[model samples]
Target chain A: MFQPEAGKTHLLNRMSIKIITYLSQAPASTDEICHTLAVKFQLTSDAAFLRNIDNTLHHFDALGLIKKVK
Target chain B: MTDKKEHKQAQIEQQLALKASEDSLSKNKRRRLLKGAVALPVIMTLHSGAALARTSNMIGDAPAVDAQVDMEGRLLCAHPDPTQPQIAGGPYDLGMMPSGHYEKQIDGNGPISLDNQAINCRAGGGVVISGVAYTSIMSRSGFNIM
Candidate 1:
């Protein structure tokens, strides 16, 4: 994704695309996103799925794409 | 010599000078033509070289795989050879999957313009999906596996 502010373009994987698209519609908690992705990806395990989603969420937090809602 | 003879000699010299001048003009014209002939190819060579450079830099560090973009600046899937060009299509809905193509992970902080769709992917390679950061940079380049 291209960040005009940063003047940089980021290349994303499929999973990232899913998360961004999901977030674009509305904000959701980490667990909500993790659950949605788990179903879509047909993930069998919860630990790895949650970890990946959490990591991605944290990364996005750093990027400021989404924020933690109170 | 007689005045008449002198006059005749002068006329002859004048004719010779005129002929020399004509010859000189023709030589100059030919020299100009030669220079132009040589310069034309050199100029063409320079232009083609620059064109090559721009093409190579078009994608910056992004892989040369065929990809497309939608009207809304969303990165779609790969083009099927002759059917679609790498940068063809309209705005693709965010949630919907574009066309079918292998999912290639492009990682780079390089600038990607919506105009040329020039993407620079240089970083780690994997299927990892990181979080989204807010930026004016609207489009992300990728192909849908569907």
Candidate 2:
């Protein structure tokens, strides 16, 4: 969950849900999803931002929401 | 004496050149023989190693058990030996069970799939359907039973 430089709350949970929905259709790697999210939100695709997405992906993996495709 | 010395030197040079030519041919043959000697054992070793690995992974006289379902047709039985090398990286090795393996309670339905059979057993208790044992992760709600 990245805090946007504004008054709006960081919707990490909502993004997690969206990520789950995206993964439900097809298996995607962390990098693929991170790049897509970065493009969709117009966020800078830096290490920190990618790390946040990877964290969410890992959380979903732990919960069995998404599986890492070989 | 100078002429004789020069003739002797030329004769020596001719013999040296002839010996060099013969040695080149023999060197090529020796190199080929060495390559054959080294490559034969290396290839044989790799081939034998692969065959041995295959044989080691084989489950000799493994039980021929078939997948069975309960009378209600809502259960899946396990037949594969978990300890077998053949099944090490198989589907059951990981979470072969679907997410619905533990759904706690059936939601407003008369028709549920075979995968949701564990839902009837609630939490804290495991359900063994058709010889397949399913251990619940959550005591009330949630998933993964294999």
Candidate 3:
């Protein structure tokens, strides 16, 4: 079995919390999440930010936190 | 008595050979007839009828059928009715018949007018936005105008 790095888990946990909070209110697209993360979290529109969001979402999916309906 | 048995066996072998030759000739004749143009259309017609019967049987055994049109006047996915509409919104809105609905908005083309106001509809509970600019460069040009 492969395990995530300690730093990676910590970063994912923070992003997952924010995403769950937003998604709980209403369903949003990936673009919507990106925009919200930029405005609320002050995350810049950089490759790192985008990659982090994507990886965190994938982790959440593996954990069954959210599902893709369409 | 041994000679009599051997004679009967020889007669049976000759008869079998003659029957086999007749069978082979009949098969050849049938093959020639099948290769002719007259036989082609007859065989094709029978095949078509058989295919139609098979398709009809399959359609009869299907669970259910339903259809709907999208915002672009195109047919969307097929699903059971009363479940959800395949597409809904704009000029296609027939008002709540247990079907889905789309919100209206200005498109990313031309000038914003009532006629140009495109509706966003949901197909089977998923939102569908039409005439929106995609991520491609050509679509980005259209988005820039918006």
Instruction: Indicate which candidate wins on TM-score.
Output: 1
Cα error of candidate 2 at position B39, Å: 32
Worst 10 residues of 1 chain B by lDDT: B42-51
| lDDT for each candidate structure | 0.45, 0.43, 0.40
Q: What is the TM-score of chain A alone in each candidate?
A: 0.85, 0.70, 0.72
All candidates: TM-score: 0.33, 0.28, 0.27
Task: Write out fnat for all predictions, comma-separated.
Answer: 0.00, 0.00, 0.00
User: How would the docking of model 2 be graded?
Assistant: incorrect
Tens-digit per-residue lDDT, B72-109, candidate 2: 55443322323322332222211222222322223476
Per-model DockQ: 0.01, 0.01, 0.01
Compose the digit string of candidate 1's lDDT tens values, residues B1-146.
99999999999999999999999999999999999976542100111111111110012122233334334443333223232122223111222122232233332865355323323211221111111210111243333444
lDDT of residue B38 for candidate 1: 60
What TM-score describes the B chain of model 1?
0.30
Q: Assign candidate 3 its CAPRI class.
A: incorrect
**Which pairs of residues clash in candidate 1, taking residues 3 or more apart in a chain or in different chains?**
A1-A10, A2-B137, A4-B137, B70-B90, B71-B90, B71-B91
Q: Candidate order by TM-score, highest to lowest?
A: 1, 2, 3
By summed lDDT, the worst window of 10 consecutive residues in model 3 chain B runs over: B55-64
| Clash pairs (backbone) in predicted model 2 | none
Q: What's the TM-score, to 2 decimals, of chain B in model 3?
A: 0.26
